[model samples]
Target: MIEPSDGAPPDSGMTLVEVLVAMGLFGVLASILLGLGLSTQAVTEDTRDRTGVNEEARIAMERIAREVRQSAGLDSVTLPGTPAGHTSTSFTFWTDFNNDGARTNTASDPEVMTYEWDPDTEELSMTAVTGLATVTRPVLAATVTSFVVEPRSSRWQYDQVGGACSCADGITTWRELDNSAVGNYNSEPDPQELRFADLLFVSMTVEDGNGTQTYSTQIDLRNRS
Candidate 1:
């Protein structure tokens, strides 16, 4: 080895101080990289979970809409909305699965269907009733937050030939009647009221550890003015 004129010692390996400083810097860089990696993983997992929740909610809504679109008319819509009645997390209607489109809910052929969403169980269930046998089954097991059923009903429009309002049958405007904020309908509606229910509105919400998704749609009944 060659030394400078004023050099006291020759070149050597790294000193203890240099080694310690290098190690500290390396440790900090490792920690930062690890933190960034963990954060990215967390975000990816959250996105996946949220997407799953949205899909589940969508499927459920579609199933309900499909059945309701083929329904004859509304039978019973639970409380806390129009057609007020005792509070129940369920709605009953006449399914036109049979050949006839009769809006009847008798215990004869299991044509009557009821959809119930129990908040306590966080699940949706369906019950079909008939004189012979009554069948009940689970529709889906989801974290449902709310399941609301609303009726789109209407009354006939009277004569407007001379700006005169007539209750007598002339021509059907097919406009919904605004009797009250809640309407003059309720559970166990009369035959006329049942016929008035031309549309069924359903809204649902699903909430899980991931997030919440709301789905709503209005389905038309078979009845036409």
Candidate 2:
């Protein structure tokens, strides 16, 4: 090393105070980045959960609609015992899977289909009859909170000259069927009138870790009209 000239200052590195300040600033920046990352992760997880619930609800509704559309007529609908009586939990109908356009019931062939909602299990199940054997399958697994099926009738009276005639028009209007109305129809004197409903309204509610979603659909019976 060479000797310094008179009144010249010595060169040196950063002091301890400067190093401490720099380290503190770096730590603060790191913490801010970490917080932002955590928040983004949380938001993504919530969106995923919500999307799952919606997808499940859509699939379930589609399955029910497809089966209902193939129904020949409504067999029966059962509601839970409640004062309000706002929900129906089970439904049975005749489905023409073979496209025969008619209901069939023989020792070797059966066409009854039933949809049941089990509150205890939070599941929706379907039962089909083939000949003398009955097979039951779970349509939707747990997480289903409610399943309701409502049937409505549409009757028309044709204008006959100057008087009204008993002829159903091709157009049909749908409405929610109540328990009392269902019971009255079931007690009809004619067995042919037991399956009188022309349209069905299917609704369901699903709940998951994210949230709850409700879906509704309308199905028209092809063979009924």
Each prediction's RMSD to truth: 6.7, 7.1
How would you encode candidate 1's per-residue C-alpha lDDT over 1-225 as one tens digit per residue?
567789677768899999999999999999999999999999998888778778877887787777777776666665443345444567777676676756444566676788988766777788988665677887755677787776665333422222345344433221223232233423344344445667667888887555677788877775433
Stretches of candidate 1 off by over 4 Å are 1-9, 81-85, 98-111, 130-133, 156-192, 208-210, 223-225
Which residue window of length 10 is worst by lDDT in model 2? 156-165
**Candidate 2 lDDT, 33-116, residue by residue in tens:** 999999999898888886877886798788777877777677766656522443437778777777787666654556787888
TM-score of each: 0.69, 0.67
Cand. 2 TM to true fold: 0.67
lDDT of each: 0.65, 0.66
Highest TM-score: give the candidate number: 1
